[model samples]
Target chain A: MSHSYEHPRPALAVDCVVFGLDENGLQVLLVERGVAPFKGRTALPGGFVRLDETLEEAARRELEEETGLGAKVFLEQLYTFGDLHRDPRERVVSVAYYALVKLSDHRVRAATDASAAAWFRLGDKPQLPFDHEQILRVAKARLQAKVRYQPLGFELLPPRFTLAQLQSLYEAVLEKPVDKRNFRKKILSMELLEETGEREEGVSHRAARLYRFDRKRYVALEKAGVNFEL
Target chain B: MSHSYEHPRPALAVDCVVFGLDENGLQVLLVERGVAPFKGRTALPGGFVRLDETLEEAARRELEEETGLGAKVFLEQLYTFGDLHRDPRERVVSVAYYALVKLSDHRVRAATDASAAAWFRLGDKPQLPFDHEQILRVAKARLQAKVRYQPLGFELLPPRFTLAQLQSLYEAVLEKPVDKRNFRKKILSMELLEETGEREEGVSHRAARLYRFDRKRYVALEKAGVNFEL
Candidate 1:
């Protein structure tokens, strides 16, 4: 409801922290601002939530308009920031969202609205504006925690991936090396992966069988509270 | 940054899903509405955000004003609700806050502005206004998940409690019975509790030693990524 007081309303904005996984490690999508505020600074892709759409829709639209990403992807609300003076001009409350996508599948290309949009290793991201660095940290923690309890880690992997690739995704997100035998035993015991009878084509060493996350079982187990710890 | 679209600005409100633990089990504070829209209907304690106050401040103030609870309590931003038709008179975007308080410390007393304010067992709570039911569910799940990693669960327990009481708190929140031996082993290993050199009174059987949570150690261990899981 509009505040019926003397003070002005805080400007509401929605920002997207897009996460992608690649051969190097976990990465975050960054866009160089083209606006007056932090004109040249690189930050999470986002904009004001328009009157016509919901918060999620605004995030997706902003992601698409700023990074050429699509709405038909995994999107979850990370948190909302309303600390006074977070923005220099006025009180701006931002609803932050975190998204996971396969870097191999959705390549980053600068959109017309942004100076540049690129994927940077999360550990090596540039300084962001308006407490975005903290927002990104929360998003990363959410991703790490969610991966251990949900099959959502697959969102950062290709449709068909090796068990090693999946394991690496978990390691990269958790920021800790997992015991190979223990990780495999725990994950395989979940019975949520489907072997496609295919093997890695370009690797020189032993070929690992390609597997896809079983969406049906993943949803069922998610509802049943099955912790998918790596 | 108000929207320039044809529609008028929607009203914004803040609701609190205050959770407290007592002999009755997990409970939430509810207030009977005194205004029109949902007059006399029992709902979450909330009100319109003032122009000068931040969303959090608004939440905290509204919570206390409507329930007679004070600040400096365990409060966290739960989620935002913005369904267009959720509010009948207008489109009200609510920032919901979830608070954990020891029921023994602050008993719910009807506020001057509320028809009545009281504690209701979460599972037996009546239908709340707007999407408060959904917000309450999210609040409970967040509490359950957070209890594993954060020491905030102690907010729901008495200042001095027995091992059995502590274990029962975890069981009630987690909704799963835990082995007493395992529970005691894990919790005592934290070394974050101080024995009061006393035991629970008024019990017919053996009295258990009472312990108080060590806030200093909890704050330190929290930074070290120590989790208080069952």
Candidate 2:
């Protein structure tokens, strides 16, 4: 059966720029197109929106089907891309989303509609088809700007992490080295991190202390108009 | 002309919540729908996306056609609403935008597809149709949260405004009583405002000195990662 509309409608879709971080730097997830239009070429994990699901639902579903990412990752709508010639076949309006995942937990594989799923270092990703490059650029800018105001980097780290790990997450996302002393002072001053009384078990040099993000306290402070800039 | 697709497609649209601030408080622009499927009901100024235009262009066109807002307002995409049953006629996915306009310069009149256009107080808006009430709520939350981290409140004020007007903009957006001394100190410390050497005119009260928002300084500070939290 075919669906029809009285007026012409552009094809609606959802695309995601999944960012993961580690000691090296930031990375993004990409899937090879298993079918036509950009056949066998790499692109962000996405597909046309189904009428039965919400935009976020469609986004999560696409991420799961294409990249094998779990549904529990930190996902947010980044922006909407509506270029007339974005898709070679027709006019496709894509609602773009950005997701942050713990790199260690993301075991990617191509499933359903893709031939392969892989992570590429942020600056060294393959040339993407369509307007996906612009989408990725916007997502990176949003992530970099948002890191100063929101604690979204926590989603890219382990639950209990060291100050070095937290600081490195910021450095990786912001793509700049920060003064260690000032970074620690500002993060600790916020009092949104709780020392977990646990230390790194396996380390080369010294066992750095571990800390957990105090989300409830952060929420309260945010409500009280506290600044979280670094 | 009718259009057919192999797969079902959700109709896409662009809606704008135009915010204007005055001595009283924040207000939103709404237009009475002249077409069917919510005819005669007041709603955000919006219309369906044309295949030829970008989403932002669609939003600007809808605002112009429905509310007669100029093209120079500070407009930003707020969020996308894609609930399964948001539209009774069909699945209509709306990319919502929020705009800040100086109230003193606004002259709203219904045009094109709308019967009337008017401003309503933020908290005292009339019954809205097609999930627009929820859209308005989201727009308000975004405005309140965004006012702290960015200098968006300046868009709602005239180019040369006094400290009292600035303070009132914050108070209105945040919906809270801010300490006057602290607010003044914080705002002044940022140096994003330049003394215009002008004073309020034709006022019954004492004339207050006017200052202009320094956009160049703000862009520089933002690029340098300066925190503008109030």
Candidate 3:
């Protein structure tokens, strides 16, 4: 079967900005291109959208194909980049998505048309090809703005984490130092977290109590008209 | 000059969800289609994208071509809809945009392929063609969720509006009543509005003081780390 149209169409593609947090700082997933146009240059994992898949499916497929990592995580549509000269070869429109993954869940490996895959600190990343640099900037700004009002910081940390760890995650994303006492008081008052009855293990310093995000309670409170702002 | 690609591409289009506020309530602009595949049906003003124009440009152009109302308004990309069977004739990917316009500024007029253009109360709008109803629903939800945290309510009001009118606009979009004293105190404390030293004219009731949205002050406050929450 074939499809025809009178007007010219621009090729659609999907790009993914995978963010993870670790002991160092906030990091972004990058893949080195193995194809020409920007051969051997680092860029976000993405590819042309196939006729069969949705934009999000295309994004996830490209992400897995380029970087050997797949796990259920927080993913959402970030923005659509469609400048006339965004693609040097042709008129291509890219629907970009941003994903947050727990660093410990999925190990990264390069495959397909990607020579290497690695996580680099967001601010100290290498130059990217195409319009990826701008897309990354937009995604970073969105993450910073949204983390304050939403419970997305939990996506980057382990399931059971200390308040210090959560605060560090917030500081990493927001690029600011948060008052620990105020942060703890505010977050605890929200009642979106549950004490895990455990403490951080394998640390030299004083162990902090661990807590898990209460997804069910959060959903209930959210439905009951509660705003989670930090 | 010509371009060729092996894979079939979906035809791209741009749709606009123009919102306005009046004495009745929140309203959305709809145009009657004059072509096939939902001809004569009410739909949001939109058309196919041109090669040279950006997605926003296409949306703005379509808004002008279908309904002759084009003043500077708050326009933002809402989402990109790409369901396989959204359009009956073919697979068409539409970039949806939501715009806020002052009803007093733009007088709706039908033009081009539009047989009629009118503003219908959002809750009482007619059945729209294609996935326009879904698009409108998404736009409405976004407007409601965004208005509380951002100062977007001012976009739907006149430049110099009374506090009562402002509260009404908020109540209309939020679909809920706000406490008068609480609303007034919170809004005034933000210092984002300036008293214009004018009063409403030609009304049956007593005149109310008029205030203008101080965009400059809002920007400064925003940069100085102030949160605008209702």
The DockQ assigned to candidate 1 is 0.33
lDDT, model 2, position B223: 94
* lDDT per residue (tens digit) for residues B1-230 in model 2: 78999999999999999999777799998998888789988899899999889899999998888778879989999999999898898899999999999888874343232447888887787899999999999999999988988999889998899999899889888878899999999999999999999899999999999999999999999999898988
User: Which portions of model 3 show Cα errors greater than 4 Å?
Assistant: A1-4, A107-115, B1-4, B108-114
> What's the TM-score of every candidate structure?
0.91, 0.89, 0.92
lDDT per residue (tens digit) for residues A34-124 in model 2: 8789989989999999989999999999998888888898999999988889998889999999999998777434323244888889778
**Worst-scoring 10-residue span by lDDT in model 1 chain B:** B1-10
| Highest lDDT scorer | 2
Winner of 1 and 2 under DockQ: 2
Better of 1 and 3 by DockQ: 3
lDDT per residue, candidate 1, B131-176, as tens digits?
Answer: 7788888888888888887777788888899988888888888878
lDDT of each: 0.82, 0.89, 0.87
Q: Model 1 reaches what TM-score against the true structure?
A: 0.91
Candidate 3 DockQ, CA atoms: 0.43
For candidate 2 chain A, the 10 contiguous residues with the lowest summed lDDT are A106-115
- Misplaced by over 4 Å in model 1 are A1-7, A108-115, B1-9, B108-115, B202-205
Residue A30, model 1, lDDT: 90
